[model samples]
Target: MVDAFAEDEEPISLPLHASSDEIGRVFNEHAERRSATLRASTERAIRDHFAEAHDGQEPPERIMR
Candidate 1:
């Protein structure tokens, strides 16, 4: 499952007797956190670009939508 995220460089440590359900729950929680982080980063980048384009002013609401 770690391969799914290309996280081969990082080792995942779990209880040796971890069940399938436990592993799935951990994977899902990790994926959700990663998704939220990526979304925030992308939004920040977009806001920064628009701010620069508008001389530090916020872009139009329509354009943002």
Candidate 2:
């Protein structure tokens, strides 16, 4: 699992006065950001794998089907 806070970042703690909706928004934003990061990393790994196996040729279009 990915760490919530990076080396220079601080952990988020909700204040006692935080509303339910405000807390939900914070969780949603964090989830979306993490999802995007994972998507990009997955794409890079797939491309690298194809490149090594295909001797630098482009991956076949059929792979997407």
Candidate 3:
């Protein structure tokens, strides 16, 4: 399992006797955190692109689409 992560990432551990529900909960929490991080990063990238294309100001909402 340690080989699966990068040097800076920590390996996750579950109780030796963990139930299926417990394992599912752990995976769900990890996925939620990863999803949120990706979403914020994507938003930041879009904002940066719009600002650059619009001379440091965001374009009108309709044009964003």
* Model 3 lDDT per residue over 1-65, tens place: 22222422535679999999999998788767766766676677778888887785756664454
- Which pairs of residues collide in candidate 1? none
Off by over 4 Å in 1: 1-11, 60-65
Please, what are the lDDT tens digits per residue for candidate 2 over residues 1-65? 44534521434578889999989987787777777777777778788989888895878664654
- The per-model lDDT (C-alpha) reads 0.69, 0.72, 0.68
Candidate 1 lDDT trough over 10 residues, lowest sum: 1-10
**Collision count for each candidate, in order:** 0, 0, 0
Q: What's the lDDT for candidate 2?
A: 0.72
CA RMSD of all predictions: 5.6, 4.3, 6.1
TM-scores for all predictions: 0.67, 0.67, 0.68
In angstroms, give how far residue 17 of model 1 lies from its true place.
0.6
Question: lDDT tens digits, residues 1-65, model 1?
Answer: 12335532334567889999999987787777777766677678788888878785757664553
Ranking by lDDT: 2, 1, 3
Worst 10 residues of 2 by lDDT: 1-10
Superior candidate under lDDT, 1 versus 3: 1
